[model samples]
Target chain A: MFPTPVEKRSRAAQITYQSLVPLALILWLLPLIAVALFSIRPGVDFANGNYWGVPSSFELFTNYGRVFFESDMPRYLWNSVLITVPTVIGAVALSCMTGFALGIYRFRGNLLIFFMFIAGNFVPFQILMVPVRDLTVDVGLYNTKMGLVLFHIAFQTGFCTLFMRNFIRALPYELIEAARVEGVKEWRIFWYIVLPLMKPAIAALSVLVFTFIWNDYFWAVVLTQGPDAQPVTAGITSFNSQFVAQYHLMSAGSIVAALPPVLMFFLMQRHFIAGLTLGAVK
Target chain B: MTLPTDPPTQTWLQRHRMIITPLMFLLPGVAFFAVYVISPILQSFYISTFEWTGLGSLSEQGEFIGMQNYRELMSDRNFEVSLWNNVKWLVLYLLAIPGGLFIALFLNQTVAGIRVYKSLFFFPFVISQVVVGLVFSWFYLPNVGLLNVVLGWFGSEVNILGNPDLATYGIIAAGLWPQTAYCMILYLTGLNAVDPEQIEAARLDGAKGVRMLWHVILPQLRPATFIAFVVTIIGALRSFDLISVMTNGGPFGSTRVLSFYMFEKALSEYGFRMGYGSAIAVILFLIMLIFISYFLWTMWRDERAARL
Candidate 1:
């Protein structure tokens, strides 16, 4: 809006702007477009040095079938689902209560506790890598999906709590006050009043945390090793190594690895954007 | 009105509900956070003082060689390269802010299919960085790679990731793909919330193009810009996945940022020197702490303003 609408410009200018938009988008997404192209080409295309030519034959089904059936990709994808879903549920449930507590109540250390979560969320993962891995190993959860899930739930709660608390703070205070005046129990107030209103936030966070945990490669690499517990992001590396130089297969594998979060984003675009742009609009 | 509420079990909960309710709610989250997030930070600092291969128990295997690892970091050439690359990353990665703003301004329209276009435009940010790295590596692949084929039209070519001098820049370019998209979405959202009346007023005074953007538009976009800046900086520092997948700190280890370097020094491939890795991690932590403190300070100020 600040740049003035293209409709306000000359007819030629409007047409030019419209044409340029797609051109710019194509250029911006060229690399991904190439991969999308690569994923569908026959395995012989790379060996034939026909990288950019139109695919002689579509091997979308064949390549993807190999990824799914001939490899550990399914195991890794399952591991990712296993790791991500629990983290989303655990983090969201924990943060809902924490957010309610921090947002609704006025008490000493409230701001301090909130800031601690804030600070912890921003600390680089490298710092946490050694100790968190050690902690997981010592607890005998090492190399297990449960280990990864538990760490994720804890680490993600930091950000989730920050988001939830701010969202809870924005809710009407009068509703809570009225409930208090009615002598309703605090837990019931949270359940019947606050929890119902937190639906949008919860939905937004679930999609967000799903993408985050699903795409997580660092902790997956550190806490787990084999396909037994490794998520797809890390598993994709082994997938690449296994099908080394088989561009079609590797491209297919990469797309498969990156699919869930991309699907999540497209389906939940509104909530995903809302969750991401939380503080952007003031 | 109070008579029906005087149940026997209601005495304690009613008397101190405010204090107790919050405490009850906070315990699980805090306990988990403390064990997983907080205490480990302290433990890392302690671990940095000892030499251990990350085998056996820490108390028995670790020899307390205080400050030796830090001393080694001072002379370590790989550490030096990694540190410089991180500086380069911090500087170059910020270009995404302006790049995103340019695209966001271009796309902030009501044209037909614009929503689909915007989503397609933002597609990169949603995909995992690992995939992005793999995609870019293929894009930069020598001989028959897309880049070389394109460059052949001009009869000029260069191997990007295979060259030591250019490899870090190549990886940074790949990272900017998604980072710019992220910033673009933020700016688009910010632009939606911009005041039309203010824009009209500025137009009346004959401000358009860069003048209007500099004077009227950007001031209103401060919140979005702050978020963009914070995320870009953080993302720049947390750039392990791209390096790992693309070059694996290759072309003579020229692409190692501190994050990747720490992992290389401390864990996989290299034998585990937990002490050395923790030392490197501590430095990265300290560097990040500077920005984290500033971010918290700004957020705290906003919180106070909102509370009052």
Candidate 2:
């Protein structure tokens, strides 16, 4: 609206705008398109430097089969799922209760607590690296999926609390007040009254958190030792190093590693964008 | 102002008892913050003073070295290089904003498959950075790479990733894929909320092209710009994955940023120097603190104004 709609522009200008769209999009997504092309090409074609040319043969299934059968990719994929699912459920559940409290109540040090969460959310992971690793070890959760989940849930709560609190704050306060006045009790006010209204926020956070924990490479390396527990993002890096000049297989592995989050984003693109742009427009 | 016909407001507040209500809500979040977030910060600050390598017996005895790590960093050329590269990254990473905005503006047109265009453009962000790194690495592959293939048409045979001068730029380009998508999404949301009447009024006043955008558009895009700026800075500073993937800060450590350097110092086969790594991390933390404080101050002002 601020730039003025294309329909209102001069005919020449509208024509220029329409012509540039595909060219720009092509340039923008060149990397992804190239990779997609590489994934389906036969290995012999990649070796001969005929990568961009038409694949001599489509060996998509064979390449994909090599990735799964020859590698510990299934285990890695399972580990990623094991880590991501728990982190999402734990982080969202914890933040819901915390967000509800911060939004609905006004007590001493409320602002202080809120500011602390905001500040914590921004700090680099390095600052927490040593302590968190040590704590995980002490608890006997190191090198396991549960360790990653616990840390992610604990850390993600900072951002989720901010999101949930801000969302709950924007809701009509009178609804909660009326429920409370009717002797519905504070807990029921949360369960029946407030919880039902947070569907959009919950959906948004779930998709965002799913992508985040799934793609987490840093913690995957630090906490876990090998393919037995490592997530696919970190697994792909190790696999790439081993495969070395096996470019076709490496491309196939990369695509496999990237599939889950891409699927989630496409399926829930709206909620994911909503969650990501939390404070962007506000 | 009309007075409430019911009992005074104090009675209602007393029944709720302001003291207990917020405390109940604040406790779990506060306790979690104290245990996981706040305490670790203090712990890291304390660990920075010691000479401990995370292995072996704690009783193996690491003498307390006060500020030795920071002093070593002062004389360390690699650390200096990494720090300078971080400065470069912070500056160059801002390109995502204008790049994203241009794409958003281009795609803002209503068309037959604009939705597909938006998603495909956003496809980069959905994939992991690891895959992004692999994709770009292939794109920059000397003779077989797409870039080389395209360049070969013009009779240019340059190795972009292997050349030290071009290596950092190549890695930064990979970083931009997701960063640009992120910024484009933010701008799209901001554009959605722009007041329509003002655009019509400006157009009627002979404001078209750059004048319309420069005056009427950019001011309303402030919120999105602020967020873009913050995320870009953080993304630049936090660029460990791509560097690790594309170059591994290699070819004589030309692409080493603070984050990767810290990792090398702490955990690489060259031996674990947790003390030195913590020092580098502390510096990164301080630099980030400047941006974080500015953001917090701005948000506080906005929140306060909203409350009024």
Candidate 3:
């Protein structure tokens, strides 16, 4: 509306706009497209300096097969799933109680507690790095999948709490008041009344957290080591170093590491966008 | 006699339950959050005052060397370089806002397959920064890379990432790719909710093109812009993954932003000087605290206003 819609423009202008759309999209995604092309290229293509030309042969199956079989990629993928799934569940579940409390109650320190979560969510990861690592090592959970999962759950709760609290605050408070008047137990009120209404928030938070934890590289590198616990993000970096000039294999591995989150985003695009843009419009 | 009106006892319990219920609900989240987030922040501040290598018994944890690490950071050349590079990153990263707005405006119109186009444009943000770094590294690889090949057509060739002078910029470029996509999505969403009636009113006043956007549309896009600003600032400050994957803060450490530098000092092959690393972390935290305080203040004011 602000820019004057293309539909209201002249016929020639509309045609020009339509033609330019694909051109701009291609230019924007050229790097990713190149990576996708590289992923299917045969290893010999790089050696022969055919980097920019059409692939000498399509080795998509061989390259991807080698990545899955010869490397620890599958293990890394499994680690990502192990780490991400629990993190989503733990963070979401914990935040639900916290969100319900802060959103409904008007007790002293409620605002302070809510602000703590919001502020904590924004602190740079480095500030927590040494101490968190030390804590993990002290607890003997260092270099383990559970260690990463636990840390992620705890940290992600900060953001999830902020999101969930704001969401729950926007819900109809009359229902909660009605339940209270009915003399329902506090926990039962939350369980029966509010939780059902929170389905959308829960869904949004789950998908967002899944993508976030799955794509996490920093904590993965900090708290874990090797295929024993490392998620695919860190594993892919190690894969890069090991493969050296094997761009084809590296490309395939990158694609594999990125697939889950990409799939999640596409499947939950609306919810994902909604989650991200929660505070943007208003 | 036993039923002597247990009213006071029941009232006392009920009164306490009001407080206890909320605390009970808060316990799990608050406990985990305090241990992982709050305690670690305080501990990091404490650790910054000590001298330790992070590789010894708990009793042997380094001696108290109060402010020594911070004093050293004052004169440390790498620290200065990192600080300067961070400034550069912050400045250049702002380009993403306008760049994204332009893209969003271009794609905002309703057209067939526009949804797919928007999704494809946003593809970079969904992937890990590691992949973005790798792709860009390959793109800028001296001769055989796609960028160099494209440049060669115009008879220009440059080793973009390998040169210290251009390495940070190169990495920032890579970072901007995804960041721009993120900003674009935010703007597109913001544009969707813009009031059509106001636009029509503005057009009636002959406010077209730049004047219309400046006086009418820009005012409405404040929330989107604010979010973009906050995210871009944070992203610039926390730039580590791309630098780690692509250059490793290299070309003689010219690209070492504070985040990566802290990681290097604390964890990488440089050997863990936990105290010094904590010192750097403390500095970064203080820098971020400035922005965080402003953001929180604004949000708090908004919350209060909404309540009123």
> Which residue runs of candidate 3 sit more than 4 Å off their true CA positions?
B1-11, B57-59
Better-scoring candidate (TM-score), 2 or 3? 3
lDDT of 1 at B256: 94
Check candidate 1 and list the clashing pairs: none
* Whole-model lDDT, model 2: 0.84
Candidate 1 or 3, higher DockQ?
1
* Docking verdict class for candidate 2: medium
C-alpha RMSD in Å of predicted model 1 compared with the true structure: 1.7
Interface RMSD after interface superposition, each candidate:
1.7, 2.1, 2.8
Question: Can you write out model 2's per-residue Cα lDDT over B84-199, one digit (the tens) per residue?
Answer: 99998998999999998987887776667778788888888888888899899998888888888899999998887798888998899899889999899889888888888998
Best by DockQ: 1
The chain A TM-scores for the candidates, taken one by one, are 0.98, 0.96, 0.98
Give per-residue lDDT, candidate 3, residue B23.
93
Better of 1 and 3 by lDDT: 1
TM-score of 1: 0.98
Clashing pairs counted in every model:
0, 0, 0
Question: TM-score, each model?
Answer: 0.98, 0.95, 0.97
Candidate 2: DockQ? 0.60
